[model samples]
Target: MNHSATAMAFRASARRTLTLEQQAIGELIAKLDSSFDSACQELLACRGRIIVTGMGKSGHIARKMAATLASTGSPAFYVHPGEASHGDLGMITGDDVVVALSNSGETQEITGLMPLFKRLGARLISLTGRPGSTLARYSDVHVDVGVSREACPHDLAPTSSTTAALAMGDALALALLESRGFSAEDFALSHPGGTLGKRLLLRVRDLMHGDERLPCVPAGSPLREALLEMTRQGMGFTCVVDERGALVGVYTDGDLRRTLDQRGDFSLLRVDDVMTRGGKTVAPDTLAAEAVRLMEDSRISALAVVEDGKPIGALHMHDLLRSGVI
Candidate 1:
């Protein structure tokens, strides 16, 4: 075929595949019934971990399903059905729920384990394209993930079927997540190395410069003294405190700009004359993410970490950036 015809052919094929997968997912919305609810209830009621199993392409989908369930507050893991016959069947127990994925509902490797699953008293939940197949009949809850056709021209490859099954798995994971009142903080606990965890788990105390690193000036100190402290700490600001070591105000870069604009004599002015009284502050225990919001809202770059009306630490926007809380 000509180059133009070849490009047209590729585009047509891509469109067909996307259209079929979209339809497959859309059909699942209509097909959702009490069975989906029962599956969620069974999973929620399970006292032991959720065991997901399948073979070949179905096994790949099962692994992802298990990971999603595990990350979303449900305890789950994937076990290969073929390996189960060899010895991995010991991984399952009577209290657990077994989620099996088989597009045909007749894979020998999975069907062969049905009697054992029953004998072990583990509840079976099956996702299969064939509702009347053996696996579905044996399952305690059968979710029909059947698609009318595959995206494949030969109607053989697992295209639309796998997409539908994946969508169903996501639906189950999120439904159970909501029913269990799983919060973002709970999700963050499982993902401590990711950006979301840094935002949710990090506090001002974790990122603030405290103790000897804190920059401070007495209320009546020279403006030059505060500027020196700001330069020495390299935090762009200095806390102004009373003789009792209580925070009275804050002197920042903005304050410096205004002092310069006024063309005041550096030798005669006290830090209190130009400092902002009771500037934006956060408790040491406050979430760093919340501090980010306050800084963005106030259009400031630094905050004094205060406790018991005393400046305990100082935080800068760069600190948050380094910690990945931004």
Candidate 2:
């Protein structure tokens, strides 16, 4: 066959798999009932973390599910079922709850450790295909993650089952999150390494150009002197300060443009005369993202960073854009 024919065949296969998976996901959504509530109850009752465990392909899904739970207000971690027999069982504590994943519901490693989970006072929630299996029989809560067939052509691989399990796990997490009134700040605390973390955790003080980098001139300073100060700092603006260095007004490129548009005499004006007095300013403790929000709201590109009425620094929208916060 030609390259285009092969590509078309591959696309056809992919489309079929995606359609099947979407249908399977809808089936899983319809299956949410009392069992899901009971499982959430057992988890919420736990005084400790949620311990997720599975074997092989299911283990990979379990690990990711655990991470999602941890980041979304539920503390969770993955423990390999095979490794549990090899002294890792110590990781599961009495106060914790175990979420075990197995498509067949009869995996040797998981079945062997089912009693241990209960014996340690840790309640077991089983996600499996066979509801009548021993693991499900002993489980305090059974969530049927049964999939008719996998996306794989062979129909034996764990594709559809893993996808269903992941979707179900997300459903459970988000439901619990809503019930518990979890907030974005809580989510950001868990995702400190990602872009969301930088936006939520970083403050105006954290990124502001301060001290030596501040562009400013005295309130009585000449317009030409303020222009020189703006040039020296390269902020395209200069703040006008009182005798005690308190922020009184600001002069910017836009202000200069407007001043020019008015056909005003620059030589006759002072920084205080041409500057915008009592301009909007932000506190040093404000969040950088909040600063960006304020700037966007006020339709301004640059702002004076002030603390206790004194201009301490300056910030530009370009700084936020470069930092991936905008």
Candidate 3:
């Protein structure tokens, strides 16, 4: 084929696939009826974790749905239908909710276990393209994740159908999350190792250098002494405090450089003579993300942790970076 023809063919094929999948998902919006509500209700009322099962390509979508549900406060896990047939059926219990996915709703490995699920008295929820299929007929609630056609040119691959199923699963999970009033804090607890967890769960106190490690000096302390403290602490800044140990000013390396350029004599200078007064400070309980924002806004690299206007701790950019709080 000619180069122009090949480029045209690629664009045409990609556009066609995307258009088909978009319409498939659009069709799902109309299917959001009482059945979807019933499924969500059943899942919410479930006393135990949701058990999602499917076969083949549908199984892959089911696994992703299970992970999304688990992370979004729905509490779910996936079990392969083939495994369930081979002694994994014992995992399903009376208190659990079973969500079975199949594009045709006739996956033998899954349909074969219907009787055992019925015997166990577990609630059955089915996600299928065919509402009249056997799996739907046996389900307590059937969420129709039907799609008109596959994105595949031959209309054979599980492309649009899987996307619809995944979207439906996400819809259900987010609905449950909202109904339960699941806050960001609750979400962070489940994902303590994720970036959102680092932002929401990590606090200034957790990364701050406490009193012993803080580089602080009295207001009357000599500039040389403050610089030595800054060097000892290696934080690039030293906090200046009053008689009550309250934060009054701050002297950073930048301020020292500026002072040197503006003045020739520094040997007799005191902390108050060069310190910048009323510097930005943060409370220990402030979010590390908020601290980062403050530092970025002020164009500084460190902040003093204050309580009741008293300097109790201090921290630098490296501390936040080392703790994965940035």
Q: How many pairs of residues collide in each model?
A: 0, 0, 0
Predictions ranked by lDDT, top down? Answer: 1, 3, 2
Tens digits of per-residue lDDT for model 3 on 1-326?
Answer: 99999999999999999899899889999989999899989999999889999898999999999999999898899999898888888888999999999989999998999999999999999999999999999999999999988999789999999999989988999999999999999999998998889989999999999867998999999999999999999888999999998899999988999989998899999989989997889999999999999999999999988999888899789988887877
Question: Ten-residue segment with the worst summed lDDT in candidate 2?
Answer: 263-272
lDDT of 3 at 178: 96
Write the number of the candidate with greater lDDT, choosing between 2 and 3. Answer: 3
lDDT of each residue in 1-326, candidate 2, tens digit only:
99999999999999999987887788887788899999988878879999999899989989998998888888999999888899999998999999999988899999999888878999899998789998898899999988888898999777888899989889888887887788988888888877898788888888889989999889888889999998998887889998998988999998899889885677878888779997879998898899999999989888899988999999988888888787
> RMSD of each candidate?
1.5, 2.3, 1.2
Off by over 4 Å in 3: 2-5
lDDT of each: 0.96, 0.88, 0.92
- The segments of candidate 1 whose C-alpha lies over 4 angstroms from its true place after superposition are 1-8
Listed in order, each prediction's TM-score against the native is 0.96, 0.91, 0.97
Q: For this target, which candidate reaches the highest TM-score against the unseen true structure?
A: 3
What TM value does model 2 have? 0.91
Whole-structure CA lDDT of model 1: 0.96
- Tens digit per residue, CA lDDT, model 1, 1-326: 99999999999999999999999999999999999999999999999999999999999999999999999999999999999999999999999999999999999999999999999999999999999999999999999999999999999999999999999999999999999999999999999999999999999999999988999989999988999999999888999999899999999999999999886567789899889999999999999999999999999999999999999999999999999998
Determine which window of 10 residues in candidate 3 has minimal summed lDDT. Answer: 317-326
Ranked by TM-score, top first: 3, 1, 2
Which model is ahead, 1 or 2, in terms of lDDT? 1
